[model samples]
Target: MGDASVVEKIYDLVVIGAGWYGLGSAKAYIQLHPNEKILVLEAENSCGGTWSKDRLYPGLKSNNLWGSYEFPDFPMEEKVYGVSEGQHIPAATLHRYLTDFAKNFGIFERTLFQTKVDSVEATANDEWALNVTSNTSTIQRIQTKKLIVATGLTSQPNMPSYPGEESFVPPFFHAKEFCNRADTVQTCKKATVVGAGKSAFDVAYAFATEGDAQVDLIIRPTGQGPVWICPPYVTPLKRKMEELLSTRALTFMSPCPWQGEDGFSMAHSFLHRTGVGRFIVNNFWNQISSEVVETHGYNDDPEVFKLKPWNSAMWTGSGVGIHNYQTNFFDLVKEGKIRVHLADIVKLDQNTIHLNNGEAFETEVLICATGWKKTSEGLKFKNFSSGLSYTTSDIKRLSKEADKKVHEMFPILKDQPVLRGPVKAEEPLRNYRFIVPSGAVFKRNIAYAGMVSTVCTSIFSTVQGLWISAFLDGKLQRAPKTEDEVTKEIMLHTQFEKWRYPCGYGASLPDFAFDSIPYVDLLVNDLGLKNHRKSSPILELLEAYKPKDYLGLGEEWVEAYGNQ
Candidate 1:
């Protein structure tokens, strides 16, 4: 009787993409909710999702330290993680660690490798029709009550469409293509880098330090902020302690006893803006300014170039300025070792870049350092969507046309818990469809690595995507029984700026200090967190709360192997 309990090929939950968030949620959910029939589907062979694919980059390293960068359940191997040149662990080492974590957590057993998801459609029964396409000859259709999308934004690389882009006489490619440093060097001698973003800097730095390749990068106007004193991506504990004390003192001494904004505090604004992507930041960004640096294109935008208080929420990332790391790229350019052009790219002829400003560059290699876009247009989810398709036009059209406000196709009841400008007494339909949040409830299937919640913007493509599956398990919720209801939720959320997204802008940082309280006591005290969730949020509900013996430290887990 016990062996037949799980005979159904169909599952209660299906997690797409076995990446960091997917794996993390799998471990967490399995530990927290036993007996839940959950299976993870991965498209690639071998694990470590992104890391497994990018073994070509010879000396890749993370920007953050091994200590702060680790997941709560898994810590990096101490011997392999200690820094010599300021990085926590080598990319390859971290990849191995992730492999180990999966084994210990038992995530590998339920994963379907090399199996591509063909289609996912909802039935009249409120369940989902999931079509799985495998490299092998078998394609299976399974039913699941919930779906989790753990594929982060960088799943697809964005390639720019420059005129004559095809005319590039030399071979062209994105950073994702080159895995090893030797390949990076052999590809370009006088490399022309396009786009001045984090990836551009990362590519540049990789070429410079790892492969020793010289690069001439073309930079457009970065964000609109004053030249900040960007620092190196290194952490000196002494400096950190000083900054912490200063921040603490400033916080307490503020006129309103709140975390007030300070003038040109680079570190303060960095954590807010960098939350947009999956890349770990070096924190050196807050120490540099763009004024001293030079790049291609219009350096206009008074708002980004000008200084502002640290209103990370009000800025909506639009207020952000060019990060400090890119400015450092100029130092290489000014040495006449690498060149920078200010003209716009007009055309591309075989091996030559035509600029509108009467400039042309002949090249053997061209690197489009442009960032990736977050739409699923090219993705094969078409067959899987089962009639679910939301083009950018569809979202805009629905927002303009819808009169009645419904959450996920269900009619909003009286006294619906509407949030921001999502559900109104009048028109609804304005949210970005990727999220597909709650219809009439205050919450949605949204939450990131405990960072972004539904408040900022429910990132349907990242870890926040998994929360959607989590919500699906609880059919107990009354709102959102159909697809139309889901559409209504999207349209309604589009009314306000995305700063309201959980784990996005304006979302208060968690009080890492109060974690010392036991889960039972914390539930009773019921701080502001309780207003949004039960006791310690997911930690309390899932019984994953870490009991702390001191401020900001959980001694229980630390002492698990004590007495040695």
Candidate 2:
């Protein structure tokens, strides 16, 4: 709303969404291509993306440690987050960190706050035309050579409609909206939460433990796979185990390794395609899950509730990384303050929620902890000739087709145990190496940030931003040149996905929820940066990498590989 005057402006890069991903993307591009003009369009009034206004709910704390979750270039101010600074910070603290990061890195000045992009499509000249609407109701057209969708994963909230939900008298909304109005729940007598993710548990836990409201956590039988409950931080023993089975060592064991040859490689495809490799990775995670369950006294029974393979899919790791501070979650259930109902709601009346188990519950508030829509759907693009919307479904279909070609080429994988499951290609905005969609014919200039799910959200986003920038700057290589090659690569990744998270289909997107170290190494190595690991080889091979250990690595990489 700063200026109603609409003018056409051309930028070298137009980044949508001013959240963490957007900020990182803009920062990376500007740092590398200092002369290039980059504009970040955020719909919100302030920075921080999800960590900003959308997140200020009670009991909402980070799952990952702040030490690893912070921006590499800018360290978070000490004594601001967690008990001793650098632990699991609260949502408000994270919001501050993001805004602070933008200010420190000069990302705030180039960002267009309160600006929303309505649509982006490829023009005749291969450039992108973005129809933007500002908070002032003013419209503007932006033309850019490259468009980076940095909205991250949680852009659109998925609000599933129930039969009588529209007529419900009490407060009813998605978890995102509920967070926006969490204060109202303090007065409510009972709160009913639907879904089985971190949001669901957090909302239910907050209402039950903190407020006067009794909470009913309704987990649908047909919902996404079982949640693997675990503490947010990895213990000393777990960290040691991660080092022994590090990607560096695993890559050496692989017969087909990712060479420093191209923009992308099928090295991971080869590693995970084999049964032995799959067994080792899966077994390692199983051990971790067992340890977490034993340590926390969490339940994960194979006969009653099969734990989703942690190493299988992205974002499927220890389901909700709740902080250790919320230790009374299960205790609340035991004390009858929080009720865990493992059944779906059959119907909802004006004052009652009828479950599939024929049990009727009365609640004053109903919160849908249901997950968001596929992040790919947030990327609204159109096929230049067909005028059809480029959707997440299309991405899934393309990957499926790619997988088909791969199975045909590698018949041995056709009968592979990992390949036996139904292809879970439902989520959208599928990209090559979790960035740009290689299957799309037009607008190849667009790259997606934050599509992949990892334990360390900020670190993953930062690396993605740098990778996108390097790809745009023509410093790194791209995915395969041919469709067949891309298909083969995606097929192996899909198989890898299956082996890692067997129940990833329940996820909103195909989360690349793997260890952060190797993924970052892949990005940095592909970007042609020098080995950024500062630790000793023995330590690197023995311990899991954290953000604190790699502080300023991104800056170092930019200085070494930028505009190469």
Candidate 3:
């Protein structure tokens, strides 16, 4: 049954990737335009996207609190360790929440499971044509007036190529493959994890505590030396703030100028642009962080504390959030349950891995907690295994051809910088709001979701979906209007990312680098929602911001805007 048959269909809009972003995007768009023909194609068998079953590893927990991880409208009711009171929830709980969100919003019916998009190209009518293959190897051609790429980041594994590691006898794999391979992990006597990000730490902890394997955490030296590690910030005042803000609709509104778009409230523009607000906030952050660090024994070792890349305030602002360890990780290191090694792997022997610092360790399995490769590699389509003729489509090649045609059609957009080929992992994506091409191509047929990294995944994805939908519906008022403006904004934002975060993950894209809440407010305001503050100007200036209720914000907009 190798391409024995082909099916063709046309849709008003087609969304790729059935994860949280895709589902949320589809729901938001469809809610506004109920009559539109929509289709959602997912490579996996179910919804949840990144939170799907395959990515759920043992003892995996969110970096942020569950309250922030949940959608504004659909809150988690479970009393799990990390769910109810500003704690980290298990990966499984988050998956269940995502599944429920899709069902609650009626996004399941519009979705097609186990279908992979092979290619998407612009048609002559300014529409898009997609070549997709199903899990069963059935091929189809789909034409849609609009396309939404919701695959976001984390779709591909960013595997590191180590020298001489190919000769190792034990199994070596990325963290993404470790979920169902627990048995394999248990059999290993010694395991080594590369990198020091959240996933790297998670794998190391599991191997040491669960599998009882002697685990070595390999960390590379950055500008600040060792990576920063700290406990979650769940002070009573902060928890009270979250609770208070969550029920108020105004907290979701951003008063600041968003990505240089116009129409920002004068007060907000002054505070955010003049550096006055940040200075005040910074002082407050330092005080709270010092108190927390002292109270929790976090500063018992002055040398280790000084080596942190960021202070607690800066770390939270950098989107690093806080790591919620069930037990004190440092104590484990002290107990010798987990060993920390600071060196790069130079080479590997049959039974040992040699470090550049001249230390060598016998490794049975090497676990790479390294993040995924760039979005381009993950989004790049492959031909079906069945070797069907029409099933083959190259997304990058098609995008270039479409870009040329589109530019020829709109000559003014021709001068705009077009990403002619695959984007390298090291470079930041040139997307406005991290969801649409910031160039002057004037193309609304394609949009992106979930490309941004923020402290609040659920709320961020929700606002992104709403903003993208509003953009496609022409409800936005201050989008960058010229080629030069787009280019200027992109360069400025890129530099800001580097200046703010300086290195590792945060250095690439500063979507929500320091203040994710403010970023959300900006997106919300751009969606025609009024960013309201307290009646008293003094209170507005002094209030500490937190994630708040956005459910009413959208509803109020629907009532006021009438869905156009």
Q: Which candidate is the best by lDDT?
A: 2
At residue 312, candidate 2 shows an lDDT of 30
lDDT of 2 at 519: 60
User: What lDDT score goes with residue 524 in model 3?
Assistant: 73
Off by over 4 Å in 1: 1-8, 55-59, 80-86, 180-182, 209-212, 221-229, 232-330, 378-436, 439-564
Candidate number with greatest TM-score: 2
lDDT of 1 by residue, 214-307 (tens): 6655654222112122233213322221122112222221111011122223432333234431022222222212211212211332322222
lDDT of candidate 3 over 310-352, digit per residue (tens): 4343333333435577776666666676777767788888989
**How does residue 269 of candidate 1 score in lDDT?**
35
Over 1-564, each residue of candidate 2 has an lDDT whose tens digit, in order, gives 234454348988888877778888888877777787777788877788777776678888777654556776777657554444335677888887788788776777777777888778888777889887786545578889988887766768888777787677888888888667788668887889887777787888788767868888887665554465565445564442223223354323322122222222454444456666556645655566666666545444332232232233222532445434546566666667777776778778998999888899899888887876655354467654321234657655765665565554333334332332245544333346657666442235777787666566666677788888777656674335676665455444544444334454323334433444556666767766644465676654444455565566567766775535
Please give each candidate's TM-score. 0.60, 0.82, 0.79
Candidate 3: the clashing residue pairs are 82-88, 158-372, 254-521, 317-514
Model 1 TM-score, all chains together: 0.60
